[model samples]
Target chain A: MEFEVDEELLDIFVTEASDSLEQWEAISLNLKKNYSADDLNKLFKIAHSLKGTSKSMGFTQLGDFIHKVEDLIAWVIRQDREITASESQFLLTTHGIMKKWLTGLQLNGNTPDVSEVLWTIGEYLKGEIENLDQLNTSNNMQASEAHAATETSQRTGIEFLKVRSDRLDSLIQIIGELSIHQSIITHSLNNNDVQSNNFKLAVHQAAKMTKEIQNESLALRMTEVRGLFQRLERTANDVAESLQKFIEVTITGADQELDRSVVEAIQDPLVHIVRNLVDHGIENEEIRVAEGKSARGQIQFVAIADAGGILLKLCDDGKGLDSEKILEKARQKGLIKDGTELSENEIHKLIFLPEFSTSEQVTEISGRGIGMQVVKDTIAQIGGTINIVSKKGEGSEFHINLPASLNMIDAVVMELQGNKYSIPLQELVEIVDLNNSKLEDTEESHPLLNWRGSLVPLHYLSNELILNQDYAVQREEGSLPQAAMIIKSNDNLLGFGVDRIVGHQRIIVKSINGEHENNDTLKGATILGDGKPSLILSLSDLSDRLKSNHRMEAV
Target chain B: MSEAILQTSEQLENDKYLVFRVGTSYYGISLSEIVEVTEKLDTVPTPNTPDHVIGVVNLRGEVITVVDTRHLLGQEKSESHLNFVIVVNTDKGKVAALVDQMIDVRQINKEIIEESTSSIQSEANSHLLGIAKAEDRLIYILRFKDFIQEALSRLNGER
Candidate 1:
């Protein structure tokens, strides 16, 4: 008899198995604190369900292994005492094996050979009999703590339709096309001066509909960060155990949702940061006791939906970043000038510089200074910024502000030498008439503009960006550089001398992946209402480039 | 499989190409690679871009980089506007190639194309696959990827 796995049933089993494994992890961590019959029942239900599903699906080998674990779970439930540490350990081991088999099945069509795992689990089940007397009688509480979580999950009956990501991508592309056409229609209508109110109203409604559809399609790609945080909790525990330290991980705002792509992109950096927290951030129990702090150090992972983006913070109450040590290392590594004076923020940022690890001892964890630089690069790649703050004995917090979405932005359109350009709206402080604003020139220093009583360095659009050295200075009669944009990034402000303001619009940004992708002055290009590609300017990138003024002339 | 694709590309008359004029020279870009062709539109010149870059223009909803074919062909800068854009789909995305004039699409016999360019002295036309004869004119078949590769190398080498 051939045992052939039904494709549909295997899919169901895989989904159910993964979900059950996730729940198993959560409840197992809870069970570690106090013995809960409800949690045990939930876990038992999952094991029994998998055993039944796998047997029915004809994966007899997988079914048989789970059936053994199910028997052990039944025995544990039948016991009159609180679960012993030895029994609990075995229970966790059973769950681990089940998770591995299910994951292996997902990656490959066939179930893994679990004979060795089955033998090991059988040994633990056999050993569980001798552990019955190990439980203290006082620890067993026999009353029903309502299985509230299971009740809620059953009542909610959350229904989700799995969608191929490519379909959503196609939907977005169509919406992008719709927006472009809508813009062209509106542009033509306005140009031709259509007097019909009904036609104008319809056009506005269509534009609004396109924007809504774009947002909804974007929302489809978002997933809550709860799963990410839960997994990191286990990672923290493992790192702490290896380091022989006691560390508690507290994660908040786990329900906050980010684009799945953004989450995937940031997960590695987050993992490294958490690993650093457990390895380098948290001090050992003995050292902590000497410092008059709790022996168990705490690491907090918090994500907050901020004004324009998500603020992810990883703070640890352990040994803070040694700023002096970092600066010294930077000097030793020739990363800094001999007598460079830096603010505390700049000093803290030195750790992110290449080959600037302050730690005297290198470890498998993070001492090569590779992790922090990776953290910096990953965050920057997503147009996010990271800032570090620390107190010597207290702790350190890494604040990461990631944009709410990656491919879309509200942009202000402007013109430089008759070409349209889009600048992120968040970066533009205000737009002023260049004629109304007073301007002054300097030879050695940057040009100055007296913008509303404050002096700002002003740069001509074509000259600053070097788009064309030969743009006809011969303008029509009295137009003295039509407009100037007050672009800002943090505390630095620069006035961009432009020819005209093209108003504001929300645009879907398509990334320039090849050829000009490495261009520092531009972020990506977007289609305008008139159906032309306008380059989106990165304010931070522009500010950095402007301050340096070293690379602009490189070409 | 490669031979089958080549056979289909041959399809009795060989591959279809979108031929255009750069000065007196005629160049052929594979028809399969072209997305759209348009009369010259207003282009916003990107600052500090390579000299051959015509500018970035709005094509439907795509912001495609426009490259001047005449500049790459090393012909004398024409006094008249290179007012035609042939948007080609490259591996990177859609980029518009500027031409002084556009000719008609024609299937070039693969056997007629001269693969070796030793006799052709123009470095600008170094990436030309070969010259193919059709009717009364000789059309230069271009290797699109090779042209972009050479352009990038030249840009990098310029610095």
Candidate 2:
């Protein structure tokens, strides 16, 4: 039978299916921790909803497959039998199949072997039930997969809600347009001859209404990180079980709300961290027992909001990082000097270096230094910071801090090189007045200032960003500014020269539009309260610009 | 063609081609596809978009991505004294293409069908749906959806 589905409905269906699949993956990962019945219920609900929608949309193959997966999950929950390692992998594979089928359905196509696939999945479900009884009888301590399945079964059921991202995006865009219209109307009224008090009040009320609408629309797109964190538990379990070791995963602060985009971006890195904990961090159960520790290794994921950022802590109580070993590895690899005065933090940071690894044998999870470096780069791109703390034997904890919102931001306005630049207040430490004696620019010497005992590099934003050349020339033969702002990055601090401070303002950040080469330095653009356009400085780029300036001076 | 309602109203009885200019050539888009004419304003630029997409603009708060007519029609960009955004509602979505200036909307009879030239590919061949001769003026009709398809295809190739 033909289905009367509009293109919009089809688009929504595809988006919803994919979103559910992402959530399913998260839940599957969460199964590694003690299974809360809620996660399983949530997973079941998503599968059931997809089944109904796909069937209605005439995507019979996809619909049938989802039905089978949902049925098996329901049976497993009812039986209260622990899921085995192979069974967990089967569920993951089922998720992959569903994703593949959904892609075909999205393109208005059908998946072949739909029935055969469902039958195979059914066989796996039956096999899992049979294995459950055997697992219970054997009660093997080494059976970690069974342990994960058992834990997953005991948790309270969670019902999943399916929402199309396109709907959310369009809603957000519409809200944005409304705000823009309100701004335009306000601007037009200011220019009009009849400037009455009632007109001003009306405009003010409109602005306030639009702002509230925008906030509500944006809030609708946020989901808690619990779903994302849950997946890491399952991943750690799988890895530990594969290595024939006992590992227990714990989750803390699961109720922290994260933007949908952040939740999606953090998934891969979180998975990688879990893999590392299982592979390198967690010792074998025998070794762990011998050390007078619990036979099962423990990995904890904690989420919290600190200051203006969301902090995610992934800690594992296995074997913490060995700073001496890392230093030794660095020296052996000729990447660092032997006996160089490097702090624990500095040594730990080396793990993110390209091709830096202390592993003797490369595993499927990690050993190639590319993983952590990628995590570092990705986190930075999302305007997030990651700090690592590792003790020699206790464990390692990766603390990740991310901004609340990347699109709109509050910035501190400052004049640099006679041109205006807005700096994100998150990275700003403080502003200090530099006396004439403290500031010196020689003919051959670079603009490097010695602040305190450490040398604080001085960078001129005008020279670095070349704003003067791009816009109007800012050199008006005026006295040098006395106040220099000190900004801090992960480890280094730099002082920037600005003409004057223009106080703080909230700005609607417009992303730098184009596929230009200069995208690296320009974070985005923002319109000020008075309708003045300002460039929001990228802290990462600012640091790089400093290095480049020094390199140019050296040349 | 005979059974189809050729003329729905006396005003529309004359095969009037809604003539629009793309670069130097006078092109016509069927009146049925034409939604409205509005000034080019409030275009939100989409970053990393394909080349032909000038950007997206909110028309009554509806974000519609606009295509550059010159770029889509494979013509060179020229400075125009007056330009307007011709909003065309196509099957893909509502799009407003940049037009060099909207000329007069006049009447043209169906008898002016000229067999497309051999050397000069049919204007109908590249989203130019049909051509009609009205006195000395040749009105080039465009298929709105087909035009958008071709433009998107060209962009896909470039990317």
Candidate 3:
């Protein structure tokens, strides 16, 4: 027997299988909460399509496995009975195993052994194994092994967004036409000595059209956060089940949209937050009830589109953060000096410090070394901020504010050492005129600026970035900076001195690729209105470098 | 007879190269690797880049990193002069290389290329595929992909 596999067909099958399994998992989770016939029919159709594709692709073993699952679904549909909790669990577990097999097929060009899963499904079909408990007890080890395999193979898959062909075609066509139009405008403006009012008006209209097209193109990458919320729901369910807790996960504004890249980047931090909430924030049933709260803890995910950004609130109706305990822990860990005065909010923020875990005993759920610091860092990497608000017993709320798009940002351009650089407006506290402001220069340390009564360390941007040799020479000769931009990093205010302040404008950032590793000074490059590339300064990174240097000097 | 014809056709398909001048030397890159050539545009200086990299330029709406051919090939930097940017397609993306002048697109057969020897090998010349003698000049046929790979590896190594 000879078999020839069509590589393209296999790729299509893998993509389809991956997508179908994702839908199956989501729908099955939904069905578990409330059984709906329409949802069940959707599952059946997915299974049927998968079976047909697998069989046609000559994956008989996979086809057989799906066939048996299809038969069980058909039987359930025929009986017209609402599935039990254990039945839904079995289906979810089956979904997990099939997904594992799909990953194996994608990676190794053939499906892995699924005899245990097949036999379990057979028993379910024959009414021998009636519940998930029996299935778990019988094949717990095998199930775990399958899960491990799935986790190992997870890195092989690539993320893809599915856009309609016509939409893409139109986008391409518009872009082509837009470039042609731009060249035409430039040609006339460059060649013609005099510009008429009509020509100027036409150019204005073209610019407006270009802006609209840009917005339209950017909107194409905007996806609803529903998918991310659904994944979080699944995580919450799994974590709650493992910890023997009851939690009702409610989501508001799941339809709110974010950039696809931002959504993907935020998934891990969101999942970690959910797990931490379930494991530590939410109390157990007995404790919750004794504390005059509902037995089923409430975890709510609310996303709202605010001005130029999205605000996500993850609220848990559990035992709130104990500021006293957090402060005590911080002191014990030597994170803060003894008798350090702090507000309640500052104490609550201590949990986000590295190696700050309030868990007395390490658990498999949340406290396995990865702490809230990682969550904060991940959020910060995407130009977002996470803050916490809590009361002693009224539960805690984590507010995450993220920009609508990752690439476009409003920035204040500054001239430094004859070169232009921009800083994200969100990072700027205020711009101060050096000539008008009170500045203190001493031989002992870096110059400090008395900004609103508090002394802030002032660093010359040109001197720090070494933009050119002349700046260093000028600094040696004691030349004063023209202006200073105030930046807040790590709860400390720092002043960055620059040559002059340019006006603020929205710029699209483009990553500077190849060989430039010193990202602490430069975030990326952006093309200015005059068709020149300008660097975007990373204020946080600069502040971090300054803080580390300050610490080193103190030592 | 048919096999000979097929072989000749394959040779014809692979023999074309775009030759250009950097300093006093000539270099050839495979025609397939080149996306386009245009008059050099003003480049804004980037911080923390290698000396060979002449910062980035705005090409249409996209920002592209431009590499200086003189510094890359270890030749003395040229003063004020007109140049051309030959945009080459690599595995990563399109990168534009600045050259002193565009010579001509010449077809040199694979059989005429002499394999590079150790005598002329240097850090930069290591990226050369072979040397081809045509008319009165020797064109150093560059393995452009390898050059890109080396540049990326050097960047990573710096990190």
Candidate 4:
């Protein structure tokens, strides 16, 4: 038969193969307990399907291996042979091999060699049953005819369609443009005196329809966080095995709903945190026994929906961080004072500082001072905050708070140098209006505004101007002239001075691409409902400006 | 001595390098690898991105990061009036390096190229693939991808 390379075949092959592999993994896990005739039949049918799919896809070697696996499973079933430890291992290994080949097929349009793979599996199968008499002897006294009673269950589910990301993004962009067009039509009808009621009614319907279309298209890109959370369980298994520590990773709130973008952005940081738990948090079995604790460690991920956001917590029940060692390292690196008085959380937060390390030895995985900063930056970029909490002996917990979606963002709009900008509301502790205050540029060079009790570092938006023009004063005098936006992130509270306050509006963010003369300081541009382009201010860049000013003053 | 042709050897003539100026410095890129030079590129400004990356631009539809050659060549700034973005394909990936202006294509003898040797020299020297001397003027052949890496390292080193 001629092989067809179409989307439907690809989808069916991958889905069926993945399902079979997952079933095989689950069955292998139960090999030591018992093996039912039903399980054997299921395994045989999976192998049969794999053989058919692989042959049709022109993966001859893979097809041959599946055929061998089918025969082996059938032989075990008919002979009433009990599964040996080695036989279970062989089954699991075959499942892993199939997954690897599937991934290869996904990347390149063909499967690689599997001749040696089948030989290895065949050898492993032989170790379990040296002869046909050995297999029949281990049977649970059930007659050979009993195997004929069991049959394979049929598979049924809502299928998944893999759409390329660009196609989805393009569909979203067109929907965005459609919304803009609807807005333009509404404004034209309201302004121009075309007394035709039909025009007004038509524009109103267009506005409603466009809004629904935009929302639906955006929703199509979203996926549940449970799938990602489930994968983390497998990652924990691998990490614990490699570290030679018995760590059980349990996930709570896997069913919590989150946007696909939020999940994608959080994946790396979550992986890094889990790796840290396995590498550093969990003590060795010997150490655990000495500490009078259970030899097996426990790592848990708890996710819940907070007000307007999701709160994710990763916790480990093992040796907590050494605050004293962290402080010593911080002092040695000159990141903190020698005798700095800090809270337990503050001391733990010090670990996230750049170049801060308590580990004396470097490993291939982490502790190179790269992961934490990346984690912090990634969280900040996604309008999220990660708070660390720990006790000396008790394990650490990282609380990651993130917004629901980047596309649908809630921001506090403020004006700087007569230009309007929006800061994500997640970063704002509270908006404090500073009027007739003691905000001054200090002789020490860094501007500071004494707010209530604390000395809040002040950054003026006008100071960022290259030409140093006072657009704030140049604008008409009747409008609100100056204000400071109090924002908090990474435990640092600061105030940004601006000219006016524009009420928050839901904006569709359109990334400005190519090259820009002043792109460094600007984060991204948002297309307001009215079609005006507003530049988003980079808070980190603003902090850098403050740092540079401080350095200039010192010199 | 015979008058040497400005073009390189018979094997190298077809391999044209499109030369451009970022401020006062001149740099060349292979013509065959050039994607496209676009204007008013709506680049997503990345915060804390190295000085070389002016921003990321959308070419046709792909979001390609654009680097500033003025910053790559160790210059402070360039005229925003003549913002010319030149997209080049490097071994690492496709990067759109923004320049101030486009200069004419110049051929050089590939055999006469000298590899840069200075370590304690200007920051730009580290990114320069080699220097091609043509008559009175010299052109710095920069591996733009390597230029990005070297520039990022210098930025990190300064920090």
All models, DockQ values?
A: 0.39, 0.06, 0.27, 0.09
User: Could you say which candidate leads in TM-score?
Assistant: 3
Candidate 2 CAPRI category = incorrect
Q: Write the per-residue lDDT of candidate 3 for residues A307-390, one digit (tens) a residue.
A: 789999998988889888888888888999997899998898889999888878878778655689999988988889999998
lDDT of 1: 0.71
What is the lDDT, from 0 to 100, of the residue A137 in candidate 4? 26
Task: Write model 4 residue lDDT over B1-159, tens digit each, in one string.
Answer: 123544334346544677777666667766655677777565443444445554445465444556666665667665463378776655445667778777777665566668877662276665666877766666677666566545444433432
Candidate 3 positional error at A32, Å: 2.8
lDDT of each: 0.71, 0.66, 0.78, 0.64
Q: Write the per-residue lDDT of candidate 1 for residues A1-555, one digit (tens) a residue.
A: 125566566556666766777788777656755798888888889888878887877667878988877777787788855776656644544555566566555445444465755665566567633652122111111000011122223233433334558758767776776676677667768777566664576577677767677777877777777877876675575466446678777889998877776776787687778878788889989999999999899989899999778898999999998888888778878888998898888888887876555557877655533468888888887778888988778999999988878888788898765678898876778888876777788874457999878888877665667563332233355455678788776577788777888898888887652367566667788888777778887766776877766566655
DockQ comparison, 2 vs 4, better candidate: 4
Better of 1 and 2 by lDDT: 1
Q: Alpha-carbon error at A319 in model 3, in Å? A: 4.3
Q: TM-score for each prediction?
A: 0.79, 0.66, 0.82, 0.65
TM-score of chain A of each: 0.78, 0.77, 0.88, 0.74
Order of models, best TM-score first: 3, 1, 2, 4
Steric overlap count per candidate: 5, 16, 0, 10
DockQ value of candidate 2: 0.06
Task: Name the DockQ score for candidate 4.
Answer: 0.09
Error of 1 at A134 (Å): 21
